[model samples]
Target: AQSVTQPDARVTVSEGASLQLRCKYSYSGTPYLFWYVQYPRQGLQLLLKYYSGDPVVQGVNGFEAEFSKSNSSFHLRKASVHWSDSAVYFCVLSGPNAYKVIFGKGTHLHVLP
Candidate 1:
């Protein structure tokens, strides 16, 4: 079975500051990792994904993620954040054969003025 773990339930960062959200996964085969962001009252939006090749993938805005097969981790990072970046971020794992998608509990990001 595949699962995602987000140790931080909530994160706070000052506007314009750098940010990094930790995520870890467990799966037997090569895992497909993804990062999604959900704004208040809106549906989830894909931030980025990882399967093979380059460990780092650029996402919307200034967001990006690095994949680590050995550590079983795929953490998201942003060079700088804005007030609008305040939202709930979810680390997801696609099941084998792409049968199902597992989403983490999510980490709520709060941006301070």
Candidate 2:
């Protein structure tokens, strides 16, 4: 079975500090990785996705994620975060059957001023 784990349930950082949300996945074969952000009262938005090609993929709002096959991880990174970036981030994994996807518990990000 494919699974995604977000070790940190909550993370706090200064308004202008860099941020990194850890994500590790377990799968037998190549899997699709995705980082989705859900605002306070909104649906999940696709921040980035990785299927093939470059290991490092750029995403919206100055976000980027690197896929490490050796480590079985796909961690999201942002050089500098803003208060608006506060939200719940989910690490998702999908196998050949895209309909059946796995989602991590999600990390709640709190950006302090």
Candidate 3:
């Protein structure tokens, strides 16, 4: 079975500060990793995903994620975050069979101006 973990329930950061959201996964092999964001009253929107080829993929806005097989982690990062980026981010995983998708609890990001 595959699962994702987001240790932090909430994070607070300045509007212009760089942000890194931690994501740890448990799986036998590399799976399809994704980062999704959900606003207060909206659905999940994909930020970025890493399937194959490059270990890192560029996502919407300034979001980027790196896949580490050794650590079994896929952490999301942003060079500079804006106030609008405030939302709940989820780390998702799809197994090689692609039959199921597992979502993390989610990390709520609060940006202070």
The lDDT for every candidate, in the order shown, is 0.94, 0.96, 0.93
Shift of residue 98 alpha carbon in model 2, Å: 2.7
Clashes of each: 0, 0, 0
Q: In model 1, where do residues sit more than 4 Å from their true spots?
A: none
Tens-digit lDDT string for candidate 2 (10-112): 9999999999999999999889999999998899999999999999999999999999999999999999999999999999999898786999999999999
Comparing 1 with 2 on TM-score, the higher-scoring candidate is 2
By lDDT, the best candidate is 2
Q: What TM-score goes with each of the models?
A: 0.96, 0.97, 0.95
Q: Which of 1 and 3 is ahead in lDDT?
A: 1
lDDT of 3 by residue, 3-111 (tens): 8999999999999999999999998876889999999999999999998888888999989999998888999999999999999999999976767789999999999
* Candidate achieving higher TM-score, 2 or 3: 2
Where does candidate 2 stray beyond 4 Å? none
Instruction: For candidate 2, report its TM-score.
Output: 0.97
After TM-score superposition, what is the CA distance of residue 26 in candidate 1 from its true location, in Å? 0.4
Q: 1-51 in candidate 1: lDDT tens per residue? A: 678999999999999999999999988888889999999999999999998
Q: Pull out the clashing pairs in model 1.
A: none
Q: Cα lDDT of model 2 overall?
A: 0.96
Show model 3 residue runs off by greater than 4 Å: none
